[model samples]
Target: MPFKKYLLTGLMVWLPLAITIWVLLWLVGALDAVFGGLLSVINSVAPVAITVWSEKLRNIPGLGVVLVVSVMLVTGALVSNVAGRWWIRQWDRLFTNIPIVKSIYNSVKKVSDTLFSSNGNAFRTALLVQYPRAGSWTIAFQTGVPGGEVQNHLGADFVSVYVPTTPNPTSGFFLMLPRSDVIELQMSVDEALTYVISMGSVAPSLPAATLQKPKP
Candidate 1:
């Protein structure tokens, strides 16, 4: 019984570490596949000397992550220029003309821009809101105030919140709650997400100032 208990404890300690390493390796492989494609393109059009070097670059471990990051930085710098803006507009126009592709592309592009843009309003804060039934509460992200028809219907007092499911934050419900009813938490979004994903097992600690009693 002691040996069995020790074995179980060891498994518990190593299982999470093993799974994390596997997932990381899988991500690296996927990135390397993309880098491989870029190398193929270079092999076709680049000078023979450069093509030979690029082929060797593929064998370097973890190079894919560096290449991907470099590409993103270069792309960001490029897009900040006037000429790049013109080119991006032309590129967008080309994609926008494709009937079916345009619909999907436009929708995804809008969401990506809203979520990732520095100035975007999405997921601005985390809050506690009553969900499913009254008195029940859940962690939710404040995805800005409602807009368009939803805003018109709900009026200006409501804020749009996304309540992500436990252990999997990707899928969840979107609710527009009245600003008065929503309780704003002092926790950061990452802390709130950890609490949600852990199903309340990993509750965030409130600030000392918040916990302290008011002066009598």
Candidate 2:
């Protein structure tokens, strides 16, 4: 029993670190493969001297990640200007005009904009709400208020919330519950996610203000 306890404790210490490193290594490998593929395509048509250089570049590990980051920085700088904005608009128009591509592209674009835009409020607030049935509660995130015909039927008092499942937060139920039913929590979105993913094994500390009592 003692040996089993020690082994389990050791595993608990090492498992998270091992998985984190594995994920990083996989990401680096994927980026390197993309860069290598591009180089291969270039080598096919390039002069002998250039092809030799491309092959050498492909052999360097992590260079692909550096190149990708540099490209992102340059692209961000370009897209901040007027000409770049116009070009982006044209690019969006091109994609949005295509038949089948437009549907997929538009759907993804809308979701990305909602999730990542500074003005958007998706997943900003964590809440405790009764779910599945009465007397049962789960952690949920306030995505925003219900919109369109749904809002018309539900009225202004309801809000859209996402209740994520344990261990896998990507898949979840979307619910439009009355605003009065959800209790807002001071814990941050990241903290709430950690709690959900850990299946309630981890809990965020109470805020300092909550911990301190008002002067008597």
lDDT of each: 0.91, 0.96
Candidate 2 minimal-lDDT segment of 10 residues: 207-216
lDDT of 2 by residue, 17-75 (tens): 99999999999999999999999999999999999999899989999999999999999
Global local distance difference test of model 2: 0.96
Task: Give me the displacement of residue 159 in model 1, in angstroms.
Answer: 1.3
- Candidate 1 lDDT for residue 93: 96
Model 1: residues with Cα > 4 Å off, grouped in runs: 1-19, 37-57
Instruction: Provide TM-scores for the models.
Output: 0.82, 0.91
lDDT of 1 by residue, 1-216 (tens): 999999999998998899899999999999999899989998999999999899899899889988889999999899999999999999899999999999998999988988998997788789999988899999999888889998888899998889999899999999888999899988989999989987898889987887796877
Candidate 1's displacement at residue 68, Å, is 1.4
